[model samples]
Target: MSNDNDIRHGRHCVFLMHVHLVFVTKYRREVFTKEILDDLRPMLASVCRDFEAELVEFDGEDDHVHLLVNYPPKVSVSNLVNSLKGVSSRMIRKKNYPSIRKKLWGGALWSPSYFAGSCGGAPIAVIRQYIEQQQTPH
Candidate 1:
């Protein structure tokens, strides 16, 4: 079945593709506290929306963040990463996450890098299912 809302530009446009992206704090900085995560949550969501991606799932263990995103083929991984890192860094810095500021030192909180892989096929469906089950019951 086709998902019309997912279409971009026009009917002849390509179907949206999905990817799972993982970004880490520089040198694994332990900055993903509950408070910090809360602070960044909405910002990340808005940015992802602007990029035509959904931040379907996200979590971190102080050092790294794992995000499940569904993006169009037109959205490059580098562009998405740049926007997230850039916006988060800017906002977090403005919010005065001292540890992040001290550690990153005008640099980005997320390393200037990321891990991205496709999420599709039957296995991909299984992974998304698992992720759904793992949701924290609101």
Candidate 2:
């Protein structure tokens, strides 16, 4: 009935948006490990589904992670980053991963700030194809 409502309930179309999400470890500490990364995937995917987005790919070094996601038109990039930050921090801390909890400095696994951006107009399918091509053969 209102413009705000219209914007909020817009159609869910495949817009092929590319968002770069950077999540820093709490206190800028190096906490990530392969064991922890294995556990984080499903949790992030569930949140993405709720936001009408898809986590296309994800990777991390010790201190931060980069996520490539396809977000729908109605989702706010800020809100999406918050969910990823807040939820991952809470979940990882609860798991008692020592490196994470120790450097977290207050039972937090991630920093509050994150990075997000548009795709810079690159075609999504083409990008995905290129990424796929770079993978090593099993």
Q: Write the per-residue lDDT of candidate 1 for residues 10-74, one digit (tens) a residue.
A: 34576656677788888887877888887777888889899877777777778887777777777
- Supply the global lDDT for candidate 1: 0.76
lDDT of each: 0.76, 0.76
Could you tell me which 10 consecutive residues in candidate 2 have the lowest summed lDDT? 1-10
Query: How close to the true structure is residue 2 of candidate 2, measured as C-alpha lDDT?
Result: 21
Model 2 CA lDDT for position 39: 82
After TM-score superposition, the amount by which residue 19's alpha carbon in candidate 1 deviates from its true location, in angstroms, is 1.2
